[model samples]
Target: MKKLITATLFATMMAGTAMADTTLKLVEVITSPERTETLKSIVGKFEAENPGTKVEIISLPWGEAFQKFATMVSAGEIPDVMEMPDTWLSLYANNGMLESLEPYLKDWEHTAGMTDRALELGRDVKDTAYMLPYGFYLRAMFYNKKIFAEAGVDGPPKTMDEFVAASEKISKLPGKYGYCLRGGPGGLNGWMMFAATMAGNNEFFNADGTSKFSEPDWVKGIEWVVDLYKKGYAPKDSVNWGFNEIVAGFYTGTCAMLDQDPDALIAISERMDAADYAVVPMPKGPAGKSFPTIGYAGWSMMSASANKDLSWKLIATLEGPEGNIEWNKRIGALPALKAAEKDPFYAGEQFKGWFDELADKDAVPTVMPTYLEEFAFFKDSLAIKTTQEALLGDITPEELAKQWAEYLTAAQQKFLASK
Candidate 1:
């Protein structure tokens, strides 16, 4: 009997030591000052509670995240866990670069708190879950409330026509650009987002993944935008506006409207009230519906990781209901955790409204699979160059569309080979 007791005690001792000695290396592509500070604080809290496991964090900027991740993957300097971009997930997952977490996630309790849409976005078409999604990148319309009231617009316009009309009214105001847009990178810069907004307008990439940017409905849509700019409703520098420029333009009240991610609003100082600022669904165009870009940002554990179990535990902790809510609060993020999304931190109806509507993909397609072609869709193409030329008044829209069609045809063929 004594021998049996000793044997059991020895086994228990070995197990404890094994768990205590485990370590995990984690990487997060830090994007902003606020996010960087939050990352440090979270790591400290995680380490304190999770004894025996030390997380070696390596911060990489988002601008260089993809290239860095690619290099590490080739060299096998792969961390135990990584936070990947929405578009890049498909590229990694398709190549088997990431471990499938479906089996392990099956038994985890934290999933109950996650939003269904977030789950769909984080997983593959085969129902294989890859990364645990952290936040939403849903589209929203940010209108200057002061401008709205002065224009006699009760609130944001609900339909595309009304939106255009409101912009016309607002553009006449002193020192205000009715809208701010992205251009220079042209098609490369805004095609996907244009797909979403056009989705709101019931426009789309066809079954073959090709687009006719010059179709009457689509042409009309672009014409409206062009007219808006030609009339000085949109800033001339719009051709060069990137994510950074748009955010600054909106916050400074230089632009009257912006179609951007939800976090853009949350980035504003909290002292501002919903009355002064609120988000509306992307306006519907003549197509009777509008689409908006919904991006996923998340982390997945490596299958070949030496410390798979420990890495999963750390991942589970960060994506857990409580942890998700806290991290989301510090940033302007909507929690992927369904329960966390409902927490008091999200506040009233205005914020949660789109999360509820858009999560189901009723308004638009749900879970745009992450892919690399999305980045190259418009790169170095004639359509893009022509658009830039039009912005410079060197070409006509007709000539621009003709050139774009040619570039898109060739680009699509190369991209379709992999599909």
Candidate 2:
């Protein structure tokens, strides 16, 4: 009789444990079909491991993500977790929108894997830790192995001088543009057009909380980038080409080199034979240090989430070694995980000739959220046609810089007020 009673009590306890498990309405703003599929698979495993919690991912492209989310945030319909770019973090945080992740980060093992730079980059507009970095992207040179061989160059360039010489060599090719520069497209793809100018100038709004964007050092840098567009090396239509057109140009042999993010590497390799493509570091400038544009992608947990603990558990697995490899593989993104640097997927000739800057432990965060306006001035003043005409001898760089300073002064007032 005692054994029967004990068995009944054990069954009752088991039923209670099952009921405690709950469903979490997780909303992730995934950008692509491939990434959506990858995330779904990752979430599925988490649900299986931790019974009773359902993670529902709400995939949204960059375009649709923001506008739709604005409504949700206003309606108090925030997701359990979501993804965002580090640069936009300020706008959200300043509006009293974001929940501080500092409370949970204090003892989380996965959050511990994050580096100092990662944490710094995730700081809110107020310079407080408000989010966690989930993934990152790096700007690099994508070169055609065939083009390098034809130009009599054995490998990629190491310095500013080597880069200029190589571009000139590639110009000798009958049908190809020497080095490619993007034409502007939508606001979302605008980064490619402005990256070269930003790196060459070492100018990204003032790093010290000032609006010194038109400072002499950065002005000289814009002068150089404008010259590239007017020289006939970068295609005339580049300003309007968009990412698709640029990718098409690289694939069709119209251009010898492209400045783009590493996330495109997987697509580049998959589209053609692996032998057709290789990547290198973005070239150095007057500063004498190789600077490639860098940026962060972030993830955050909602303060109001009923299953907050379970949500972080899912985050841990996704950021952990196994899930990161799977997710990074699908999207061609680099995992912030240090061990991912030496992943076997990055091995062999496919990654060869591109190993020089593979692990950018030295990369600086491309731009903080504050520098958006400053970045705009350079692109309008020099990257696009407004400055292209001046670079081509249509107007002097001196004249261009003069007009640029006026715009910078006006913009600086508003930008500074926010700080």
Candidate 3:
């Protein structure tokens, strides 16, 4: 009788211990080996601080993350927390999948330290805090100093005319191209930047909810990129190049210039020498202004999370001052906290171009039309196909502009009507 009682008590104790432990599921959509390492390090500290909690990380490749995450949610495999990009926030938040972080933010110790821009962007969806943004991604020009010197170019271009002149000069060099054009996936930002700069404004739609992409200046802008490729200024094989290909092109010296967000710096800085290249603000247009695209990503909790309080605690740990700085260091984005900008890491010469852009009166940081529910499809599917067609000479630049304008107009009008 005594032996049986002891066995039963031992079984009960094990069950109680198991019940005491909690495991939170974390999904990272922008998965990279370095990013994963940083995330794990931060999460390790969180786990250490909370004795009875563990976080299970699920990383999905960025290319297929949108669709894969959506499918997972639909199939009832939702995570406790996720890395939410600017483009995917509305889709999940509007569909009631995300838990508003406003309540938690009010009580968080680091809330006061967050930059106003971070809070503003976090409230992008329905004016509620569905996510706590970690950092900002602003586009800037990266130029190969070695390639420029070889081509006899004096410095980075400040104007569109100068940009073209430099490209022409660089293309004359043996087996060299001027621009690492991302003509495949993730090329929409380049298209938008060029069009907005040429149009002298970052306005996407007019008073009547019509897209401005079909305007003459916008058409000219699109044609200019097409002409760059046609004139052999961009690599012939670049029509199918995506993010990785373009970055490779820049570092390998196949191309002289690349306009990319700061996240790219993480990868570029790894393989290239600091003195061999330099970052600069995107060149201006005829109107003496440049519209560089700005984007952000954040940590969000799911509505279905059973451990809401614990999930919030994890979020706070990741987005808090020290954790945020550590994450952004690995992620290569501008910190979202006002205080973090003062960190010595951001004061380096590589970050000078982005800071200069922010200070420049003529450098407009343009936000994408990500509020539209159909924007993901428009950007990942419709835009890619049409832009590729234009790049390949299968469709004229005017046709490409008109198609984009019509699609965006419908989407914008639908969004406005729903409001």
Question: By lDDT, who's the top model here?
Answer: 3
Overall lDDT per candidate, in order of appearance: 0.66, 0.62, 0.92
Error of 1 at 330 (Å): 2.6
lDDT of 1 by residue, 206-261 (tens): 55656565555555555555666677877778766656677677777777788766
TM-score versus the correct structure, for each prediction:
0.78, 0.73, 0.95
Stretches > 4 Å off in candidate 2: 1-30, 63-68, 71-77, 124-127, 151-155, 159-175, 185-210, 241-245, 303-307, 346-355, 358-419
The residue ranges of model 1 lying beyond 4 angstroms of the native Cα positions read 1-23, 71-76, 151-154, 183-203, 208-216, 271-274, 349-419
When sorted by lDDT, best at the front, the candidate numbers are 3, 1, 2
lDDT measured at residue 286 in model 2 versus the true structure, 0 to 100: 51
Clashing residue pairs for model 3: none
Q: For model 3, how does the per-residue alpha-carbon lDDT over 65-179 read when each residue is reduced to its tens digit? A: 7779878988999999999988878888888999999999988888999999999999998999999999999999999999999999999999988999999999999999999
| Total clashes in model 3, counting residue pairs 3 or more apart in sequence or in different chains | 0
Clashing pairs counted in every model: 17, 3, 0
Best by TM-score: 3
Superposed by TM-score, candidate 1 places the C-alpha of residue 139 at a distance from the truth, in angstroms, of: 0.9
